[model samples]
Target: MLTPQQPLGSGFGAATTTDEVMTGIDLSGKTAIVTGGYSGLGRETARVLRAAGARVIVPARDLSRAREALAGMDVEIAPMDLLDPTSIDAFAASFLESTPALHILVNSAAIMAVPELTRDARGYEYQFATNHLGHFQLTTRLLPTLRNANGARVVSVSSIGHRYSPVFLDDPHFEHRQYIPLAGYGQSKTANILFAVALDQREKAHGVRAFSLHPGAIADTGLGKYIPLEHRVAAGVIDEQGKPVRDPARQLKTIGQGAATQVWCATSQQLNSLGGVYCENVDVAPVMKEQPEKIDMADAMRLTGVVPYAIDPASADDLWELSERLLNW
Candidate 1:
């Protein structure tokens, strides 16, 4: 049976930090891949995993910058660009040649709220291409290595912004309708969840399970760099000067706290028997009523659970097929 999207009361809450989640859990001898691991929540994830003795591989778009960011982290940096299929394939090929097993895969790289519409190398929507399709192709390409592990886990970092829009499969690249950055971002994040659900269905019997989660609204991260400061201030998420608003209702988390959910999803032993669920705050998130009209800070926090459209089995299956056709894999 498919796991229901409901909290299991895992005793962890919104305040949990990455280090707190790693307590008493050892990842020694495991191998992990964290995309975008040079910055933001991804960097912290790589750090905690490495501290637990896991060999982490980070795929970077800028080799020099990644090397500088991860100077003493003991991670392997490989060149990759989510927008470039050839680059992705080359990186995957190189990793497969040397890696025997991949115990964890964290699809944490994403772009959010770019003011203007952008397309990738293949003429696909930039948000969808990088946030969803790129990870989809990478996970599939690395399937063999994942299956080699005893019980592999794939954690796709989705977001609360997923509520902004469902996958516009008909015009995903904004060929007909206008491209709105927030809507584009939401569609991509929703795709992340659906991808996880469908992937878990296909690979669970092979000892691989997939999960997706909202890491919470975190401050001091590169993910929000593209969002205009004025808009954030208008939303009450940040001050006029660009600092985070100190509001309990805003549900803002520290970078370490924000990384908790993804790390927990990637390495927590409690999730061994469960797969294909959307999680938040370190537990299986409950399915919430669709609240498309609510986009403010408080509503964003209140609507923390997965929406119906996101976890729909039919939608998940359809997205998988669409992805396969798009990538021709």
Candidate 2:
């Protein structure tokens, strides 16, 4: 696989904040849509974007909570649930009716290490359905509005857990395999990267750029809420002390740190000529080349090279076709 990940020295690092990333940048009159903006990194992102002068719109499943989350902030909350096609359509349609230009979109919502085998209305495995497909349809539906803006950016919040596994193409919906939650989460994370690949390929020509990001680990993030405590113990992610174990698995970034990379990808002039790359902690990620068990990140800095099963163009096409059919788009 080709290694496409290269750092351009943007000067932002793991410690950078969203505000630092956007310093001196002006987003006035530009519109941004942040999914899951009511909590965690999403809320931090909205805060920085608003501070930087952008008009922020949050598409949240819970309107009441969203309002409270951003009270007194210059933000708008719209009702949209990724798993529900009607909700996504209604929200997108309502937003587009008022404007043709959209500048920034952050697909910053997801579940991690969920406990049960849940499915969406159309029976899509919940992880893949919500984390990947929902964002897929949302972005596709809003493509025209974004393209009209020129230089628009789309950010997909993925996870390093993508390293756990790729999309099992033949059994993507877990029809045959035993249901393992982390594996399901991994598939969805992998899809987030591939979605950016497909999206940037198609939309860059229209002046819209797409990026995928791994927002670090479980520091007070919603993703952790779904993780089973028993599993966490066995994995040594948490010890008898009920605190995170000292390992890469348990290490997490602060919410502000977690929001840095996507914000950087959104506004940094250093990335001015780049698109279609996966980033983490404010920089391009190295390509991963090894099979899940054998590959070390250093040996595989292929950020653009998601696992073959993950980035398979054929599978991507198949998934897109299925999503459109499911959403009735």
Query: Using lDDT as the measure, which candidate wins?
Result: 1
Query: What's the true lDDT of residue 294 in model 1?
Result: 50
Which regions of candidate 2 deviate over 4 angstroms?
A: 1-3, 230-251, 294-315
Q: What is the TM-score (0 to 1) of candidate 2?
A: 0.88
lDDT of residue 39 for candidate 2 = 91
Q: What is the lDDT of residue 166 in candidate 1?
A: 96
| lDDT by residue for model 2 (1-329), tens | 22256656667666677778887999888899999888998898888888888889999898898899889887999889998888988998998899889999999988876778888777889998899888988999898899999899999988776776777766778889888887898889988887877777777889888788876654466667676667556555556666754332223456777788888877777776577778876887665565656433222222233355555556656666665665677
lDDT of 2: 0.77
lDDT of 1 at 131: 98
Off by over 4 Å in 1: 246-249
TM-score of each: 0.97, 0.88
- lDDT for each residue of candidate 1 in 1-329, tens digit (9 for 90 to 100): 99978899999988888999999988998999999899999999999999999999999999999999999999999899988888889988988999989999999999998779888767899999999999999999999999999799999999999998999888889999998888999999999999999999999999999999998887578788887777667666777777875433345778888899999999998899899999998899998875666585446755568888999989999999999999987
**Shift in Å, residue 177, candidate 2:** 1.4
